[model samples]
Target: MGTVDRRSFLAWLSTGAVAAATLGRGGSLAVAEAERGATAGEVLVLRGATVFDGTGTGATADTTVVCASGRIVAVGRGLPGGLPAGARVVDCSGAFVIPGLWDAHTHSTEITPTVPALHLVHGVTGVREMRGSPATHEVRRRIERGTLAGPRMVVASNTLDGPDSRVPGATLIETDDDAREAANAARQEGADLLKVYSFLPRDQHTAIARHADRVGLPFAGHSPSLLPVHEVIRRGQRSVEHNYGMHLSTSVDAEDYFARLAALPDEPTDPNWWGRLAPLWEREAFRTYDRGRAGALAGLFAEHGAWHVPTLAVESAYARHPTRFLDDDQAQERARRWLPASLREQWRARVQAWPEWSPERAETELAYLDARLRLVADLAEDGAPVAAGTDCGSPYVFPGVAVHDELALLVRAGLSPARALRAATRDAARCAGIADAGTVVAGAHADLVVLDADPLADIGNSRAIRAVVTRGAYLGPTERQRLFDEIERAADGSEAPQPAGPAPASCCGPPPE
Candidate 1:
C-alpha cells in the first residue's frame, strides 16, 4: 500500500470520521441537513433579497431563498404560502445576497486570533492555504473543531523546494528518492494538496509530480523556474500560483530568458539580488510579449484544466504601485488596530529599505501589469479558469480586506463585476476542487454574505457587508462589529507580542523596478 503505516492510516480515517461527525451538529448541522434534505420544521427563509447566486448571471431582485439543513432549498420570487412552525424568517429586503468569497492563495501559518476574525468580518468564508506547517495544521484542527472562527481551509503541505530554496521551513528535495518520500510524507500528514515551489531541479520536480499523482494528492503552486509554462501545465499542475513563470512565457525568447536566469547563482549571496535582477526580467517580459503565443498558452491551460490564482493585489502593492497605501489614512488606521505591530513594521521596513523607483521605471512596471491583466482577461475569455487571491500574509497584503481589492483589480482588468465575483467564488471553488462551496444553490454549503449594496453594480460595493453566514451560523451586524473589536483587541500590543513566524517566500520573482 502507501508508505504510511496501518496505525497512521487508521488515524487518518478517524480524522475523516471526526470531520463527518462535526458536520452534523449545532451550527454545522446544515451540512448534514443538506444531504438528507431540510424539512419544514427546520427551515430558514430569507425574504426579498436580490440574489446573484454566484452562477455568473444577472441578479434576480425581490427574491426569496429557503434554507434548511444548511442548503438553499428553493429560490423564487416569493416563499410558499404558510411556512412550517418554528421556521426562522429573516427580512432581507434591500440587501444583496451572494456566495461567500474565497481567497485561494492564503498563508495560514500566519494565523493569530486576529487573522480569522478579520477574515470572517470581511465575509471571506473560505481559503486555500498555499503552505502548511505544524502550526497551520493545529489551526486547521481547531477550526474544524469549532474552537476557532475562521474560513474553511484546504491546506497544502509545507512547500517543496530544491536545494537553493529560500523559504524558511521548506522541505528540500534534491533527488528522485527524495521527491517520492516527500510526497508520501505530505500525504501522510493529511495535507489536501502538495505545494510545489520554485528552484526545484527539473528531474526532481518531475519525480515529485509523478509521486504526487500516485499518492492521489494534487499539486499546485509555483511554476519552477527550470521548467517552461507549457510543461508545468501538461504535467498536471492543477493550478499556477501568482503571475511569475506564466507571465515569462509570453516572451518569444522565453528559452533565452530562462537560460539567462539559469546562469545566475542558484542561491544569490547578495541581499540586493532582487533589486538587481527585477528590472531586467520585467524589461525582457515586456519586450518579447507575443499575443499569438499567449493565446496558444491559454488554449493549453484550458485543455489541461489548469487554473490560475493571479494574486494581483500583492503584486500591485510591491511592484506597479508600491506607494499607493503609504499615506492612506484608512490604511494607517487599520494597520495600527487590526494588523500585528511587528508585521506592520516589517512592511514599512521593506518599503523604506528599497532603493528609489524612478517615475519612468514605475510607469514601466504599471504598463507591464496592465499587459498581464489583459492576458488574464484573455485566458478567462478562452475558458481558462481564473481565481481571485490576494497572496494574503505577504507584506502589506491584509488577510480579508485585500480580496475585495483584488476583485476591483480584476474588474479594472476587463472582467465584468459578475465575472470578477465568479473568480473569488465559483472559480476559486473549482480551483480547490471543493464541490459544495462557491454557490448559493441546493445541496451547497450555507456560507453566504449579505451586502448592503449590489456588487454587480460595482465590486467595491462588496465591502458594504451587513452580515455573514458560515455553515449556517449567522453573524449579524452587531456580531460582525464585535468580531472586529475582538480583532482590534487581539492585535493591540497590550498582549505580549508573538514571535514572528517565518516569512512566506515570494514565488513571484523580485519586485518590479
Candidate 2:
C-alpha cells in the first residue's frame, strides 16, 4: 500500500528503485535493502477481514492471512504465534478479502498503454488474453519480470481463421496441413493456448485440435461453423468462447441450422458476410431454443469437463443498450484515458460510422441476448462450469471495470452471488488451467483483492476495491487512486488524434449494401 508521486512512479517503473527490499520466491531480495522495510522472509499480514477464499466454502470472518515470498504462508484466526520480528501488517477490520479476480478474456498491446494500470486499480489480477502479438508478448514479459505492474497474463496465439477473416493479422488457414503448420508455428512462439476463429473449416479445425493436443497446449475458441457444440466438446475443445455456435446447437432445428451455416462458402467474398448472417442466426436461434436440448448440452459439457467463457457483459451491452456502449460521453472519456489517443479516436469513429438500429431491431437483439443468457443459467444449474469474461478491447468494453459487470450479469442469469464470484475467480482459474491462482489459501499466489463491502451480499460490491495485492506487490487505497489519477492525466495530456483506418462496423448490424 505504498504511494509514490507520478514522476517518481514513472521513474520507478523505468529504473528498479523500490522503497522496500521485499524478497520474492526463493528468498531472493527483489529490491535493494532500504530503510523502514519488511525484512526478507518476513510475513505481511492482512488482519481481521471477512474472507471469501473463492472455493465456495462461504465466508470466514475475523481471519488473518499472511504472505511471504509472493505466496500465502498461512490463513488463521489471528496472527500465528511467533510472527517474524519485522512483519508488515495492514488493518482490515471490516474489509472483505477474496482471491484476486480474473478477466477470462482480454486484449492488450501497445495501443492500450493504460490497460495495466487500469486493470490493477480494479483488482483484476489475472487475464486470459484472447489473441497474441509481439507487442502483447512484450507487455507480458515486462509484467512477469516486475518491470511493469499488471495482471498475470496467459496469451493465445494469433487467431487462425479462413481466408475471409476480418481480424487484422489473422493467420489464414485452409486445409488440414495449413492448420497443423500454423499451430506448430504458434507453439514455437511460446503461446499458452490456441485461438481458433470463425470461418475455420471443419478439417482444419480438427487438424489444429489434434496438433494442439499432441503438443500439450489446450485449444479454446470459437466453435467453427462446421463443428457442432457436442462435436467440439467430444474432440477435446477445452473451452468454448462467446456462445458462438452454441445458439444453433441448442435450437430444436440444430441439424438444419448447423447445416445451413456449414454450407456457406469457406471464404465469402463479401466483407459483410457475418453481419448479413447475424439476423438469421438470431431469429432462428432465439425462436427455436429447445430447453431440453440446452439441458442436455449442459450435461454434456459437465461430462466432458468442458468450460464456458460467455462474455455476457459485452454481448448483452451491445444488444440491449448499444447507445450506452457506443455513444456515452463518460465511457468515451474513460476510454481515452485507458487507450492511446489514436486508438480512442478509432473507436469513436467506429461508433459514429456504424449504421443505426431501429427500435424494433434493438428490441429483437435484446430478446435474443436474453435467450442466450438463459442458456448460461441453464448450463450453470446443470453443473456446466462457467467463467466470467468481458471481451475487453472490443468497442466500449472497458478493461478491469467490465468484469464486475459480467459477474452481476451472471447473477442476473440465475447464479447465486457466491457462484457468480466463483466464475470470476476460482472457476475462471480452473478453466484457464492455472492451478496456483484464483484462490486465497496456503501456498497459493498472494494475488488478492480487499474490498470495502461484501461481494457475496451483492455482486456489484466486487468493484468496491480497497486495495489489490498482485504478485505480492501491494497497491493500497492511496496507490490505487494514484493509478487512476495518473491515467486521467495521461489522457488529458494528449491532443485529439485522427482515426487510423476505416470505421469499424457493428458486430451484428448489416453492412451498407
Candidate 3:
C-alpha cells in the first residue's frame, strides 16, 4: 500500500521480476502460452498496474484486472487460483489504469468514422453524440456490431429548435403538438436522448420536456435562452451543455439581463445576431457576477441532480482564450493535420473571419474567462455534478485530443486531478445514463486506459497513454500508433476517408457565443 516509485517499478518490470512473479506459480505461464495461440475475444488480464477505479478514491497499487466478454470479471491484488487459460496477459507494472474516458458532449456525427477512431486512439471509450440522426444511429450500430472499431455512443435526437433556428436541419417546434411529435420521432428513431437547442420557445420546450418524460427519454442540451437556469433544472433537463445561460443567470443583474434577452426580436435580421451580441452581454455578466447568486444556482443544480458539461475547451477556443489554441501556429497545424480537407478549410475561414479585438476588449474577454472558471470552481465547491466534454466537431475542437484540453482546463478551474478525471469517467457515465461503464469494478464494461504516468499526480499525464482496453480487446502502443497513422494518412488526403453515412446537421453555428 505504499507509493511505488515509477522508475523503480519500470526497472523491476524490465528485469522480468514482476512478470516472473506473476506467472511463476499456479500455471499462469501455461495460460500465457495458451493465450498466444488464442483468437480474439480471449480474456484480458492486466497485471501490476496502479488502478484508479474512477470513484474519486485513492489509487490502489499493484492491482490485477480480469476482463472477459466485454465486462470486468475481477479486480484484485492477485488471482486466487491463476490467470484464466487462453487469457492474454499484459504486464502493466509502472503504469496507472483508470476507467476509460468519455466526452459527454460531442457532435461526432458531424465528422463520422475518423472522429470515432480518433476518440479511441486518445483513450476515449465512450462519447455522447449531441446531435443525432439516422447517421449517428448507424454509427452507433456499427460500433456495437463490431463493424467499426470506435467508442460506445449514446446518441441524441436531432436538435429541436424554434423558428429561425441557427442550426441547419433542426427539427423546428412551433407548438405543443410539434414538441410531442419531435419527442415521439426521437424515440422511434432510436435516440438515447432528446437534444434541445437555444432558440426553442418556452412553451414548446415545456411540451418537449413533458413528452420526453412520457417517452422515457432524458432531454439535455443548451438551456433554452428564454428559460432561467433554475427553471431549466426544475423542469428536469438532465444536463446542461456548455454552461449556456450560466453567465446571465449568475449575474447580479440577472433579472435585467433576462428581460433584455427576452426582448430581442423574435426573428432577428441576422441569423447570428445573438452571437454578435453575446460577448458584450457576457462581459457585463462577468463584471456584475454575484457569488451569492452563483452559489444558489449551483445549489439548485445539486438539489435537482442536474449535471453540467462545460465544454470549456470549445468555449476557450471561441471566446475565453481564443488565441491560446486558435492562434498558436503549432497547435493549428497539429489540429489541421487531423482534420479532413473540407473541415480544415472551414476552420481556416472561420478563424480568418474573427474580428480584431481592441486591448480593452481583449482584457474584458480574459476577465470573462476568469469569471467562468470561477463559476466552475464554485459549482464543484457546492457539490454540483460536473462532467468533462469537448464539444468536438465544432470549429477548433478536435475530437479525442480536446478531451485532454478539457481536463486540463477543469483542473485550472480548481478541480483536483482526481476530481477532473472523475468528471470524464464516473460523472460522465452517470450523465449519459450508462450503467456499466466509467469504472474498473466487476460487472462494469472492460473499457480502461493504461497510462505511462499517474494521472492523479498530474491530469496532463492522462495523455501519456500506454494502451487502451475497450470491449475486452487491447490496443497497445503499436496498435494505437497504427490507428493514429491511418487517421493521419486520411487527413493527409492520401486515402479516401471511409464515409460514415450522411453527416448530422452542423451544430457549430456561430460558436454558440
Task: Encode model 1's per-residue lDDT on 1-513: one tens digit a residue.
Answer: 013233432232233222343332122112233323423224566778888888766787886665655556555564544344555678999999999999999864345777776788899998988877666777778877888878888888888988777666678899888888888999888899999986676787899889999999999988887677788999999998777676677788877776776566555465434323533575558667887878888888889988988898877776645455678777778888987777787767755555566788777777777776887887777777899888887666888999998999899889999999989998898888798889876567778899999899988999999988887667888989888888888785532233324443344424423
| Highest lDDT against the true fold, candidate | 3
Task: Give, for candidate 3, the lowest lDDT window spanning 10 residues.
Answer: 25-34
Off by over 4 Å in 2: 1-42, 109-112, 265-267, 270-279, 321-327, 492-513
lDDT of 2: 0.74
Q: What stretches of model 1 exceed 4 Å from their correct place?
A: 1-35, 38-42, 262-267, 270-279, 320-326, 493-509
The 0-to-1 C-alpha lDDT of every candidate, in the order given, reads 0.74, 0.74, 0.77
**Candidate 1 lDDT:** 0.74
Candidate 2 lDDT, tens digit per residue, 1-513? 233333432233223212222333111113222221222243477888888988778798887776755767556564434344455789999999999999888865333347766777899999888787777777889888887667888888888877666656678887778877877888888889998876666677788888888778988887775667899888888898887778788888888876776555444565435534643574567678888888888888899888988998877766754455565777866776666676666666666666667787777777877887898999899889999888877667788988988998999989999999899998898888898789887667889999999998888899889999987666898888887877777664533322122212423233232
Give model 3's TM-score versus the native structure: 0.86
Report the poorest 10 consecutive residues by lDDT, candidate 1: 23-32
Q: Model 3 over residues 1-513: C-alpha lDDT tens digits?
A: 112233432332233222444332222221122222222245677988899988666898888876756777556575434333455788999999999999999875435456788899999999999888676777788889997768989999988888757666778999889989999999999999999887776888899899999999999998877777888999999999876678888888888877876677675466545533543575677778888888898889899889999888876766543444556887688666676776666666656665566777667766766777889999888889999988887667788888999999999999999999999998999999997799887668889999999988989999999999999889999999888887777775632232232222223322323
Candidate 3: where are CA atoms >4 Å away? Answer: 1-41, 270-279, 320-327, 492-513
Task: Provide TM-scores for the models.
Answer: 0.86, 0.87, 0.86
The Cα error of candidate 3 at residue 307, in Å, is 0.5
What count of clashes does model 1 give? Answer: 1
